[model samples]
Target: MSVNPVVRISKVLSLLTVTLLVLAGVSACGTSSDSTQDTITIGASLSLKGDFSDSGLGLKKGYELWADNINKSGGLLGKQIKIDILDDGGTPAQVTTNINTLIHNHKDSLVLGEVITGLAIPGFETADRYGYAYISPGGLTGKITAAEKDDNKHNVFGISLPIKSYLSSFDQYVLSLPADQKPQTVAFMGSQSPFATQQLAFSKAEIGDKLKVVLDAGGSYPEETTDYTPMAQQVVNSKADIVVLGSGSSAEAGAFIKAFKQQHYNPKALIATGGPDEGKAFLDAVGGADTAEGVFVPNSGWYPQIKNYQNDVFTKSYVAKYGGTADEIASDTVQGYAAGQVLEQAVKKANSFDNAKLQDVLKSASFDTVQGPVQFDETDHTNKVAIPFLFQWLSGHLQAVYPANEAQANPEYPKKTW
Candidate 1:
């Protein structure tokens, strides 16, 4: 018991070394098996607040509904799926930060896209930096697609139709009209936002010399401009046969509609880039079903009637969960759900959680969603299979009225006066 101090210290050190080796063995065993992992997390950064909040919330519902359905079906790859959504406040910088945290800190298995092109671009760039694929509900701007071509970054994919072609269907419908019914003068008014301006440009190019330009004021107002009465008054003054508004939201379109009504200026046709496609929100903004009637909005895909992949199931599930009729469902919600549908198919096809494998499957496969068949272009990653259609409000319902094959109803020309 009273042995030399040096010998006692040597015995204690030997015991400590043996204990460390035993603990290290346990750690190694756990690491090799990775048995504790039980869930696959998908993350998204959305403009849940700020300018895009309304659309952002719609997209959120879509994502949530998809995750709920997947979980109910026994989850993906035999593991429960969890979604981590963060609000970007409609800011690009915030989107970048949220994306990094999701990919690096949370170690999310996949990342979904934002609501608009401005917010989505940053999110896509950040995801690309980490070698992750970016699948968005919207954000089909030319810059993003061009970047994909010029930079060879085939990682960004859009669920919606390309921005430049959004109004192409409408143009074709107008040009096909009889000489007497054809509109002679056209007016273009839009926000400077990339999506709005691009649609305006495309409409002009497509219409060409067939229509005289009464007002070429597209991109005349800043995106943040709240008051549209002044610009709308100019359109009324021009006495244009047709008024094409490139609105960013239902509210913007509603403002213009209200102004036109006040001035008692009813053009032969009044169509907007957005707004009327938003269902109840658009109707409410334009002062109920009566005012909404005859308003036209181009649709990339997805109407309540189209029998696309799992659309019936999606519509029922959405109504059951959100308490709305199928017609009242926001198009943004469909876009969001379609984005998830793409991701789910890619994961199942690859049979692995690896981002690289998912990207490869996405590039080669054509997946069906509520928005119809989605096949991304190898170069731009934009959906190439879905055809854009023109939709108009008829008897309080948004009906596809163009592209004879896809038309749910005939075009309501020379729309009713407000």
Candidate 2:
């Protein structure tokens, strides 16, 4: 046995070769499951079909444009950028499933998801479970990200003005008026959904004695409610100096406003929160300037008059690419673009796609977007600063009329009485 030393050494070398081959094969197979180092992939769940399609489509287009532009700029970190998306039909349950599939089945690195607050809540949960950042373009209510008591909201951030912030801005607008010009009595009308409910509660707490509440018409109006005549009648009959439509679709808001006009209820100020208050659909539904004149809404990401160098460039390019003015682009469009901008900036700062590293950068940084400076509060993960302003419909154009410095046009108080 001692005379066979060379043969024994050759046998040991043969065993090492087989082991190395097996390990290499396993590594190759595992890498194939996720992706190669040649590209970075991100996924999202959107309400591409159903009641939320308008906002969802705008979001999709914004994301697509971002991806295209990044690829044109030679991509990120020397890798091509790819975005994968699924339609959730505006359902929270579906959004959960879509996000789960994207994480577990597709193994994506990050998710940009959901416009509706309800749907975005579950999306945030799913993204957290996967240990990825979930940035929302809409869904600004703090509750959506569990900012109250739960610490799980750290991975969720957004572009929409949070409920507290929006209410504060609205309250500031009311107080900005001279004592004689300000309305003494107001009514609150909105849907019973989480967003509207949270907004109303905050409004009451923030508004305090600044204005008297003469009517509380807000309730859980089902998404399917088409006729708002009863609610409109209630608001009009209250004879309040200001009537605030807390929540409704653009069409629903238009219906209620039309009914209010028909009833000859001419309040000094008319403001709305959702749908008819923010997007282009509101103008179309309310029959243009003739009917929508002097209406006010929280900026809600739709005002084209919020001027800045970045916003001006974005609006011009958006108009050129989409063949319409910046106003034609929904807030969701800008939101989607801003979300992408945030993601890009974070990735660039970290110089890698490692989720943990990206998270650290996002939590600690501020981004300059078309919407202005966007910084996430380190604790709540909700945006700490936003360019929220109150906008009014003047003639056929939307004009910013609050916060003094940001106002594009003076408010037309005591809108024409019917």
Which candidate comes out best when scored by lDDT? 1
lDDT (Cα, 0-100) at 398 in candidate 1: 93
Task: Give each model a TM-score.
Answer: 0.91, 0.86
Give a tens-digit lDDT track for model 1, residues 1-418. Answer: 6899899899999999999988865443201121236787888998788888878988999999999999999988887778899999989999999998887777776888975878888888888877788898874888777756676676788877888898999999999999989999999999998889999999999895789998999999988899887899899999999988999889999999988888889999999998888999998998988888888999787799898899988999999999979999988899999999999999899887667777898888999898888888877878888798899999999999989998899999999988
Give lDDT tens digits, candidate 2, residues 189-306.
8776666767777777767567889887665476657677777888888899987777645777788888887888899888777654445777887877778888877754446655
**Which sections of candidate 1 miss by over 4 Å?**
1-36, 149-152
Could you give me the TM-score of model 2 versus the true structure? 0.86
Candidate 2: list runs displaced more than 4 Å.
1-38, 147-153, 276-278, 300-302, 305-309
Task: Report the lDDT of model 2 for residue 297.
Answer: 75
Best by TM-score: 1
lDDT of 1 at 257: 94
